[model samples]
Target: MEFRGRQTQKCPRCGGKALINQYKCPDCGLIFAKLDMATNKAASQRYKNREKSAIVFVKKVPIDLKRWKLILYTVLFGLFGAQYFYTKRWWWGLCYILGFTLLSVCVIFNAPLLNIWDGGLISFFGLIVGVYGVCWMFDIFKVCLGKFKIPVSLPKNELNAVILSKEED
Candidate 1:
Protein backbone atom coordinates (compact mmCIF):
# COMPACT_ATOMS: atom_id res chain seq x y z
CA MET A 1 0.00 0.00 0.00
CA GLU A 2 1.16 3.58 -0.76
CA PHE A 3 1.24 6.21 2.06
CA ARG A 4 -0.67 9.50 1.39
CA GLY A 5 -0.99 12.77 3.35
CA ARG A 6 -4.42 14.29 4.12
CA GLN A 7 -5.49 17.14 1.79
CA THR A 8 -5.80 20.30 3.85
CA GLN A 9 -5.42 24.06 3.58
CA LYS A 10 -3.85 26.43 6.11
CA CYS A 11 -5.49 29.73 6.94
CA PRO A 12 -3.19 32.62 6.15
CA ARG A 13 -4.43 34.68 9.12
CA CYS A 14 -4.36 32.18 11.97
CA GLY A 15 -2.41 29.36 10.33
CA GLY A 16 -5.18 26.92 11.25
CA LYS A 17 -5.69 23.77 9.25
CA ALA A 18 -8.91 23.12 7.37
CA LEU A 19 -10.10 20.66 4.76
CA ILE A 20 -9.08 21.73 1.24
CA ASN A 21 -12.77 22.09 0.29
CA GLN A 22 -13.53 24.46 3.17
CA TYR A 23 -14.31 28.02 2.09
CA LYS A 24 -13.84 29.69 5.48
CA CYS A 25 -11.19 29.50 8.18
CA PRO A 26 -12.49 27.53 11.18
CA ASP A 27 -10.30 29.30 13.75
CA CYS A 28 -10.44 32.92 12.60
CA GLY A 29 -13.67 32.71 10.56
CA LEU A 30 -12.04 34.49 7.62
CA ILE A 31 -13.56 33.70 4.24
CA PHE A 32 -11.12 32.38 1.62
CA ALA A 33 -12.56 34.80 -1.00
CA LYS A 34 -11.70 37.86 1.15
CA LEU A 35 -8.12 36.82 1.74
CA ASP A 36 -5.54 39.27 0.36
CA MET A 37 -2.44 37.60 -1.03
CA ALA A 38 -1.05 40.65 -2.83
CA THR A 39 2.41 41.82 -1.89
CA ASN A 40 3.33 45.35 -0.67
CA LYS A 41 3.13 46.69 -4.21
CA ALA A 42 -0.15 48.45 -3.41
CA ALA A 43 1.31 50.27 -0.41
CA SER A 44 4.59 51.07 -2.20
CA GLN A 45 2.72 53.08 -4.84
CA ARG A 46 2.14 55.86 -2.28
CA TYR A 47 5.88 56.38 -1.89
CA LYS A 48 6.68 56.72 -5.60
CA ASN A 49 6.07 60.08 -7.34
CA ARG A 50 5.64 61.80 -4.00
CA GLU A 51 5.74 65.45 -5.11
CA LYS A 52 2.14 66.15 -6.23
CA SER A 53 0.09 63.48 -4.48
CA ALA A 54 2.05 63.61 -1.22
CA ILE A 55 0.67 67.04 -0.28
CA VAL A 56 -2.99 66.37 -1.16
CA PHE A 57 -3.73 62.65 -1.18
CA VAL A 58 -1.14 60.54 0.65
CA LYS A 59 -1.97 59.47 4.23
CA LYS A 60 -5.40 61.18 4.13
CA VAL A 61 -8.47 59.00 4.62
CA PRO A 62 -11.89 60.40 3.76
CA ILE A 63 -13.88 60.33 7.00
CA ASP A 64 -17.34 61.70 7.74
CA LEU A 65 -16.04 64.07 10.39
CA LYS A 66 -16.06 67.82 9.65
CA ARG A 67 -13.05 69.82 10.84
CA TRP A 68 -14.77 73.23 10.69
CA LYS A 69 -17.59 72.23 13.04
CA LEU A 70 -15.19 70.59 15.46
CA ILE A 71 -13.00 73.68 15.55
CA LEU A 72 -16.00 75.96 16.02
CA TYR A 73 -17.33 73.90 18.93
CA THR A 74 -13.94 73.77 20.59
CA VAL A 75 -13.41 77.48 20.31
CA LEU A 76 -16.92 78.80 21.07
CA PHE A 77 -18.48 76.36 23.55
CA GLY A 78 -15.44 74.56 24.95
CA LEU A 79 -16.05 75.78 28.51
CA PHE A 80 -19.52 74.17 28.40
CA GLY A 81 -18.27 70.84 26.99
CA ALA A 82 -19.99 71.45 23.65
CA GLN A 83 -17.18 69.93 21.61
CA TYR A 84 -17.26 66.65 23.56
CA PHE A 85 -21.04 66.47 23.28
CA TYR A 86 -20.85 67.14 19.55
CA THR A 87 -18.28 64.36 19.16
CA LYS A 88 -20.60 61.90 20.97
CA ARG A 89 -18.26 61.59 23.94
CA TRP A 90 -20.91 61.67 26.63
CA TRP A 91 -18.70 60.77 29.59
CA TRP A 92 -16.17 63.50 28.85
CA GLY A 93 -18.94 66.06 28.34
CA LEU A 94 -20.53 65.06 31.65
CA CYS A 95 -17.18 65.39 33.38
CA TYR A 96 -16.72 68.90 31.99
CA ILE A 97 -20.22 69.94 33.06
CA LEU A 98 -19.64 68.52 36.56
CA GLY A 99 -16.34 70.36 36.81
CA PHE A 100 -18.02 73.63 35.83
CA THR A 101 -20.76 73.05 38.38
CA LEU A 102 -18.23 72.35 41.12
CA LEU A 103 -16.34 75.48 40.26
CA SER A 104 -19.57 77.49 40.36
CA VAL A 105 -20.46 76.11 43.82
CA CYS A 106 -17.00 76.88 45.14
CA VAL A 107 -17.25 80.45 43.87
CA ILE A 108 -20.74 80.96 45.31
CA PHE A 109 -19.73 79.75 48.79
CA ASN A 110 -16.43 81.67 48.67
CA ALA A 111 -14.46 78.58 49.65
CA PRO A 112 -11.12 79.51 51.10
CA LEU A 113 -8.38 80.10 48.54
CA LEU A 114 -5.41 80.42 50.96
CA ASN A 115 -6.57 77.86 53.54
CA ILE A 116 -5.23 74.68 51.91
CA TRP A 117 -4.82 72.74 55.18
CA ASP A 118 -8.14 73.94 56.56
CA GLY A 119 -10.44 72.20 54.09
CA GLY A 120 -9.97 74.67 51.23
CA LEU A 121 -12.28 72.83 48.87
CA ILE A 122 -12.33 75.85 46.55
CA SER A 123 -8.66 75.20 45.72
CA PHE A 124 -9.46 71.67 44.60
CA PHE A 125 -12.35 72.93 42.48
CA GLY A 126 -10.13 75.64 41.06
CA LEU A 127 -7.47 73.09 40.15
CA ILE A 128 -10.06 70.89 38.42
CA VAL A 129 -11.51 73.85 36.52
CA GLY A 130 -8.03 75.00 35.53
CA VAL A 131 -7.17 71.56 34.23
CA TYR A 132 -10.43 71.49 32.32
CA GLY A 133 -9.65 74.83 30.73
CA VAL A 134 -6.20 73.62 29.74
CA CYS A 135 -7.69 70.50 28.17
CA TRP A 136 -10.21 72.65 26.26
CA MET A 137 -7.41 74.81 24.92
CA PHE A 138 -5.45 71.77 23.85
CA ASP A 139 -8.52 70.40 22.07
CA ILE A 140 -8.89 73.67 20.17
CA PHE A 141 -5.37 73.32 18.83
CA LYS A 142 -5.86 69.66 17.96
CA VAL A 143 -9.09 70.34 16.08
CA CYS A 144 -7.50 73.15 14.10
CA LEU A 145 -4.59 70.91 13.12
CA GLY A 146 -6.93 68.05 12.05
CA LYS A 147 -5.37 65.82 14.67
CA PHE A 148 -8.33 65.39 17.02
CA LYS A 149 -9.54 61.81 17.43
CA ILE A 150 -13.22 61.28 16.63
CA PRO A 151 -15.20 58.26 17.79
CA VAL A 152 -17.32 57.99 14.63
CA SER A 153 -17.54 54.57 13.01
CA LEU A 154 -18.51 53.18 9.60
CA PRO A 155 -21.08 50.43 9.13
CA LYS A 156 -19.50 47.01 8.72
CA ASN A 157 -21.08 46.39 5.30
CA GLU A 158 -19.99 49.78 4.00
CA LEU A 159 -16.48 49.25 5.32
CA ASN A 160 -16.30 45.87 3.60
CA ALA A 161 -17.54 47.41 0.36
CA VAL A 162 -14.82 50.06 0.48
CA ILE A 163 -12.17 47.41 1.10
CA LEU A 164 -13.40 45.23 -1.78
CA SER A 165 -13.48 48.20 -4.17
CA LYS A 166 -9.91 49.14 -3.29
CA GLU A 167 -8.83 45.53 -3.83
CA GLU A 168 -10.44 45.56 -7.27
CA ASP A 169 -8.29 48.52 -8.39
Candidate 2:
Protein backbone atom coordinates (compact mmCIF):
# COMPACT_ATOMS: atom_id res chain seq x y z
CA MET A 1 0.00 0.00 0.00
CA GLU A 2 1.22 3.44 -0.92
CA PHE A 3 0.33 6.66 0.83
CA ARG A 4 -0.78 9.31 -1.69
CA GLY A 5 -0.69 12.67 0.13
CA ARG A 6 2.02 13.07 2.73
CA GLN A 7 1.80 15.84 5.29
CA THR A 8 4.55 18.50 5.42
CA GLN A 9 5.64 21.35 7.63
CA LYS A 10 3.18 24.08 8.46
CA CYS A 11 3.16 27.34 6.52
CA PRO A 12 4.70 30.25 8.42
CA ARG A 13 2.20 32.73 6.98
CA CYS A 14 -1.08 30.86 7.48
CA GLY A 15 0.04 27.81 9.52
CA GLY A 16 -1.14 25.44 6.80
CA LYS A 17 0.70 22.15 6.36
CA ALA A 18 -0.18 21.72 2.69
CA LEU A 19 3.22 22.44 1.24
CA ILE A 20 4.07 21.69 -2.40
CA ASN A 21 7.49 19.96 -2.67
CA GLN A 22 8.73 21.79 0.46
CA TYR A 23 8.99 24.95 -1.62
CA LYS A 24 5.55 26.62 -1.51
CA CYS A 25 2.61 26.54 0.87
CA PRO A 26 -0.36 25.53 -1.26
CA ASP A 27 -2.83 26.63 1.38
CA CYS A 28 -1.45 30.16 1.80
CA GLY A 29 0.39 30.53 -1.53
CA LEU A 30 3.54 31.57 0.37
CA ILE A 31 6.83 30.57 -1.21
CA PHE A 32 9.10 29.25 1.54
CA ALA A 33 12.25 29.83 -0.51
CA LYS A 34 11.57 33.55 -0.33
CA LEU A 35 12.72 33.39 3.29
CA ASP A 36 16.27 32.05 2.94
CA MET A 37 19.02 32.18 5.57
CA ALA A 38 20.39 35.44 4.19
CA THR A 39 16.95 37.09 4.29
CA ASN A 40 16.38 35.79 7.82
CA LYS A 41 19.80 37.04 8.97
CA ALA A 42 19.15 40.52 7.57
CA ALA A 43 15.70 40.58 9.15
CA SER A 44 17.15 39.46 12.49
CA GLN A 45 19.79 42.19 12.35
CA ARG A 46 17.13 44.84 11.64
CA TYR A 47 15.01 43.59 14.51
CA LYS A 48 17.97 43.74 16.91
CA ASN A 49 18.73 47.29 15.86
CA ARG A 50 15.10 48.29 16.35
CA GLU A 51 15.01 46.60 19.75
CA LYS A 52 18.10 48.49 20.87
CA SER A 53 16.58 51.76 19.72
CA ALA A 54 13.37 50.99 21.58
CA ILE A 55 15.27 50.19 24.79
CA VAL A 56 16.99 53.55 24.62
CA PHE A 57 13.66 55.31 23.99
CA VAL A 58 11.89 53.51 26.85
CA LYS A 59 14.70 54.45 29.19
CA LYS A 60 14.14 58.10 28.33
CA VAL A 61 10.40 58.01 28.97
CA PRO A 62 10.47 59.09 32.61
CA ILE A 63 6.82 58.51 33.45
CA ASP A 64 4.92 55.46 32.30
CA LEU A 65 1.48 57.00 32.24
CA LYS A 66 -1.65 54.95 32.86
CA ARG A 67 -4.61 55.09 30.49
CA TRP A 68 -7.19 55.92 33.12
CA LYS A 69 -5.10 58.76 34.52
CA LEU A 70 -4.71 60.20 31.03
CA ILE A 71 -8.46 60.05 30.50
CA LEU A 72 -9.10 61.74 33.79
CA TYR A 73 -6.65 64.53 33.05
CA THR A 74 -8.07 64.91 29.56
CA VAL A 75 -11.54 65.32 30.95
CA LEU A 76 -10.58 67.66 33.77
CA PHE A 77 -8.04 69.92 32.08
CA GLY A 78 -8.28 69.19 28.38
CA LEU A 79 -8.71 72.87 27.57
CA PHE A 80 -5.34 73.57 29.17
CA GLY A 81 -3.83 70.34 27.71
CA ALA A 82 -2.99 68.77 31.06
CA GLN A 83 -2.94 65.35 29.43
CA TYR A 84 -0.27 66.44 26.95
CA PHE A 85 1.85 67.73 29.80
CA TYR A 86 1.64 64.36 31.53
CA THR A 87 2.69 62.65 28.30
CA LYS A 88 5.86 64.78 28.12
CA ARG A 89 4.60 66.59 25.03
CA TRP A 90 5.53 70.01 26.34
CA TRP A 91 5.20 71.80 23.01
CA TRP A 92 1.64 70.64 22.45
CA GLY A 93 0.67 71.28 26.07
CA LEU A 94 2.11 74.79 25.99
CA CYS A 95 0.38 75.55 22.70
CA TYR A 96 -2.97 74.42 24.04
CA ILE A 97 -2.55 76.36 27.25
CA LEU A 98 -1.44 79.51 25.46
CA GLY A 99 -4.16 79.23 22.81
CA PHE A 100 -6.89 78.83 25.38
CA THR A 101 -5.56 81.69 27.52
CA LEU A 102 -5.17 84.03 24.59
CA LEU A 103 -8.62 83.26 23.27
CA SER A 104 -10.19 83.75 26.67
CA VAL A 105 -8.35 87.02 27.10
CA CYS A 106 -9.41 88.19 23.70
CA VAL A 107 -13.04 87.38 24.40
CA ILE A 108 -13.03 88.92 27.86
CA PHE A 109 -11.10 92.12 27.22
CA ASN A 110 -12.77 92.96 23.89
CA ALA A 111 -9.63 94.91 22.97
CA PRO A 112 -9.75 98.17 21.00
CA LEU A 113 -7.78 96.73 18.07
CA LEU A 114 -10.20 93.81 17.90
CA ASN A 115 -13.11 96.27 17.71
CA ILE A 116 -11.37 98.10 14.84
CA TRP A 117 -11.47 94.84 12.88
CA ASP A 118 -15.29 94.85 13.15
CA GLY A 119 -15.40 91.84 15.52
CA GLY A 120 -13.30 89.81 13.02
CA LEU A 121 -10.60 88.99 15.61
CA ILE A 122 -13.18 87.83 18.11
CA SER A 123 -14.88 85.68 15.47
CA PHE A 124 -11.56 84.19 14.37
CA PHE A 125 -10.61 83.40 17.96
CA GLY A 126 -14.03 81.91 18.57
CA LEU A 127 -13.61 79.60 15.59
CA ILE A 128 -10.21 78.51 16.85
CA VAL A 129 -11.63 77.79 20.31
CA GLY A 130 -14.47 75.76 18.83
CA VAL A 131 -12.08 73.66 16.75
CA TYR A 132 -9.87 73.13 19.75
CA GLY A 133 -12.84 72.08 21.86
CA VAL A 134 -13.80 69.45 19.31
CA CYS A 135 -10.24 68.15 19.21
CA TRP A 136 -10.14 68.04 23.02
CA MET A 137 -13.36 66.04 23.13
CA PHE A 138 -11.97 63.57 20.59
CA ASP A 139 -8.77 63.29 22.61
CA ILE A 140 -10.80 62.45 25.73
CA PHE A 141 -12.69 59.79 23.84
CA LYS A 142 -9.53 58.28 22.39
CA VAL A 143 -7.84 58.20 25.80
CA CYS A 144 -10.86 56.52 27.43
CA LEU A 145 -10.92 53.90 24.70
CA GLY A 146 -7.20 53.20 25.20
CA LYS A 147 -6.37 54.35 21.67
CA PHE A 148 -4.12 57.25 22.56
CA LYS A 149 -1.05 55.35 23.66
CA ILE A 150 2.24 56.84 24.85
CA PRO A 151 5.12 56.44 22.40
CA VAL A 152 7.34 54.05 24.32
CA SER A 153 9.93 51.87 22.60
CA LEU A 154 8.96 48.51 24.12
CA PRO A 155 5.81 46.51 23.69
CA LYS A 156 3.06 47.07 26.25
CA ASN A 157 3.71 43.88 28.20
CA GLU A 158 7.47 44.44 28.31
CA LEU A 159 7.02 48.08 29.24
CA ASN A 160 4.79 47.05 32.13
CA ALA A 161 7.44 44.62 33.27
CA VAL A 162 10.04 47.37 33.18
CA ILE A 163 7.78 49.66 35.15
CA LEU A 164 7.20 46.95 37.73
CA SER A 165 10.92 46.37 38.05
CA LYS A 166 11.54 50.07 38.54
CA GLU A 167 8.87 50.24 41.23
CA GLU A 168 10.34 47.26 43.04
CA ASP A 169 13.63 49.15 43.31
Model 1 residue pairs with clashes: none
lDDT of 1: 0.56
| Predictions in order: lDDT | 0.56, 0.57
Query: What does the lDDT read for residue 45 in candidate 2?
Result: 40
What TM-score goes with each of the models? 0.53, 0.51
Model 2 lDDT tens row, 1-169: 1225765665544566753466665665555443321122232243456643222111111234555677779999988999777765567789899779977777676777476889887888888888888878887887777656343333332221222232222
* lDDT at residue 88 of model 1 (Cα atoms): 55
Which runs in model 1 stand beyond 4 Å of their true positions? 1-63, 111-119, 158-169
Q: Write the per-residue lDDT of candidate 1 for residues 6-75, one digit (tens) a residue.
A: 6887654456787787767677665554333222222233234332121111111123345677678889
